[model samples]
Target: MTGPGRGTTADTPVVVAARRTPIGTAGGALRAVTVDALAAPVLAALAGTLGGPVDDVLLGNVFGPGGNPARVAALAAGLGDDVPGMTVDRQCASGLAAILTAAAGIRAGDGAGYLAGGAESPSTTPTRTWADGTVYTRAPFAPTGDPDPDMGPAADDVAVRAGLSRRRLDAFAARSHARAVDAQRSGRFDDELVPVGAVLTDERPRDRFTPERLARFRPAFTPGGVHTAANSCGVNDGAAAVALVPEWRRRELGVPGLALVSAATRGCPPADLGLGAVPALAALRDRPRSPDAVEFTEAFAGQALACLDAAGIDGHRVSPDGGAIALGHPWGASGAVLVVRLFHRLVVQGRGETGIAALSSGGGLGVATSWRVVR
Candidate 1:
């Protein structure tokens, strides 16, 4: 698929505006909200700002209502039927995939503007009864007969293989919470968060974090395993959206944007999927320069540490405003949420010029997308 070069130019696809709903813990503030309901508000906020009508809408979702979520969000947002919509599901990487798809459309000369992102409502996820009168929840994380191990156990496997100690994982989790709380106190998240009702901020960041508190939890997946609930992401609900337009349109609209540079997706074995981000970053190693900032989703502290270590990325350069470990992981929405964070930091706050967002997904998928502030 076509994509932008590293340099900013009139032909490049630029992200004009990005916003997200406050991430809510499962069964928390957003439990009653539907995926479309959560997404429509963010979409409407972007539509209110774009100078021209949107050409299309693409959204990523996992475990949402079966109908076309993008179309539902568009209609609910009052965008006309002329705005075609599509929904994609690449599990946790779905959000970044949707963004990449929109960028590809601009490169292919298919359209001038698009709305894209991802949303999830884990609290509202459906439960199903199997053919043999057994109840099942969640689709298989891997292909049938392909050894579909759950992510927590897979994370434990990654820790064991990488020699990540339990103490190290606990330390990472504590740091994530502390950073998130600091960012919150400093108003770092004020600009990008579009309120969902009275819920004004992320629900998962712990204000009084202590390593001892993390150590009190038992292993969630295995006997004497490193992965505890404290070090893993919580099921969450939220939505995020971005307005993408050609660089020329951005200029005409008199709006600032982040220029799309490159993106790649790779896969690994499902049982060791947390390391998926390692190969994704390797593909982008030859870029014009190292990314000034990186957002690697914190699926589990051990796996995140392993991926960052393998990539040789220092902890200081990753997730400055905290990550999924503190903010909660809303599956489909987490990837796009990373982009929103990058835009806020690089473009809005002038923290850096270039940034990368990377995520590891269930079923052994990894996705990475790079962006540069429009000059």
Candidate 2:
């Protein structure tokens, strides 16, 4: 709960290093890789630069085989058996939740350093069935009596309620792809990426998507819905992790990083969960200034636009290099991917002094974290 104004500078948690695997579409290049396998390389990449032991390893995972994937990944990454690990699950917000949890622990004087992030492998996730031989794609986000629409339909509802037109949504999606393609060509994503197997770059961003092509697609969720496959993120497989240390330790290591300023998580109506990020961003306290750069998960163009509009943030201020709409969304990993992108932009590229990473999740959850570049 402690933020910049509430805590001493020396004790503030900072992200010294961040890395992520190239996101791959489900059943594509990363199909053979398990969740732990996808996470191990990213963890190893961060740990290799630390030069000291990590206090713990924390990972966010959804739909994994579930034997403590964090611990499995730590061992696979060769981080020594002494380093303990824990897994967290908060649907799509899991990754950001893990990072915030680590920062909270550091603020509480629990540990000096930690490894936290998220990983998801939709390609290798197993099918689940209830004891009564009933099959289900995912667990219910709300109780039986409450609204629990699937994400696609929920996105459609957001578009309808927010008065977002199909054309506007399509344009946003096309712009996302165009920006990602441009960033890719400019080598903007080169340094943050860690090769997984033979996958070196994100597999989802296309070279182009004309408005006419995007308009030809039919509604994907409701009969008259504005949501479509092109405007939504793809199911993906990938992992991302950050090396978190207290400010004192960051100074000792002599590395630039992101100083944790504030973090918040909020809840909204389950029926309109796609708009969750608005409330979360509003909950942050002691925010000294508006973020110069923001990395918001673009799970669905309509949902993203609705949230951004409600929050009174300009679309151009978010994900200048594109977002999940182009990069693909690997469930648990998507939130961490946002932070990784911010780290690259704020710390590596020296673009801004402050930045934010925000995402909306299933079950009406939203999470937002603010950081300042510590050079």
Candidate 3:
């Protein structure tokens, strides 16, 4: 991997705008919102901030309709038929992967503007049927001949390996709710959020959550496991999108933006997949120095704790405005949600000049990307 400073150039990807729909738990307010409907408004909102036409539109999705959501969203967003679009599905990493993929194109001098993000509607997730009319809930996340442990159990294994205790996990989950509540009360999320009907705020954060209360829930994965439903991410539906442009275009537009510094993805054993981000970030030879903050997708309290420990980063440095545990993890959109959070912290709030967003996917894969705020 090219060391830190690898892509700091005129042609690097620059983020001009970022926005997201209010996150809703599965079967909640957003359940009625279709995948394309969820994404189209976000795409339009992003384009409204751009000075000119967007060259391409890319969306990441997991359990929505099979048709090209990006194309559908682009057209529904009124971007016209001339704009090309595509959808990406890398499980939980789809959103961030889509952004990084676009960044690669920008670095290659592909186009002046690109809109990339992720959208998911687990509430509306479809059931599959075979020719014999038997319905199936899911496809295997791992290749044949590989052990495909359930994600919660895999996270339990990671917690055991990382020596995280139940108390710590509960504490982490509690903190997430507290931080999210504080961010909400402070209105820190207003600018980044595009109102979705009557639900202007995320629907998952519990103002009454407490570690003591969290300790009462039984383990959801395995007997004697450290994880509980209270600490793991809830099934959610949401969408997030970002506008990317080359550094030259950003300057010409006179907009403050974040520079896409570096990005990488790594793989590990399927059973230990939640630890993927650790190796992925460790493999990065050139991460920005003295990162002011980090945002890792909160798939589970145990896995997030383990990754934070392995990366030698303080757990406090992550998700100051709350995380998936408190906010909701719309799988396909969680990765881009991390980037959107980073943009708010690094660019909007000016808390730091540089930040990194990372996540581990279901199929034994980890993805990480770094950005530097450039005004």
The whole-model lDDT of each prediction reads 0.87, 0.89, 0.88
Worst 10 residues of 1 by lDDT: 1-10
| RMSD value for candidate 3 | 2.9
Clash count, one per candidate: 0, 0, 2
Q: Which tens-of-lDDT digit does each residue in 70-131 have in candidate 1?
A: 99999999998888899999999999899889998988889888899999998888777899
- Cα deviation of 117, candidate 1, in Å: 0.5
Clashing pairs in 2: none
Which TM-score value belongs to model 2?
0.96
The model with the greatest TM-score is 2
Per-residue lDDT of 1-375 in model 2, one digit per residue for the tens?
Answer: 222322439888889899999999999999999999999999988995554778889999988779999999999999999998999999999998989888988889888889999999999888888899898688888989998999999999988999999999998899899999999999999999999978899999987696679999999999999988999999999999999988877777888888888888999988887878989988977654577898899999999999989887887777899999999999988888988999998889998888888999998999988888886
Best candidate, lDDT-wise? 2
Please tell me which model should have the higher TM-score, number 1 or number 2: 2
Arrange candidates by lDDT, highest first: which order?
Answer: 2, 3, 1
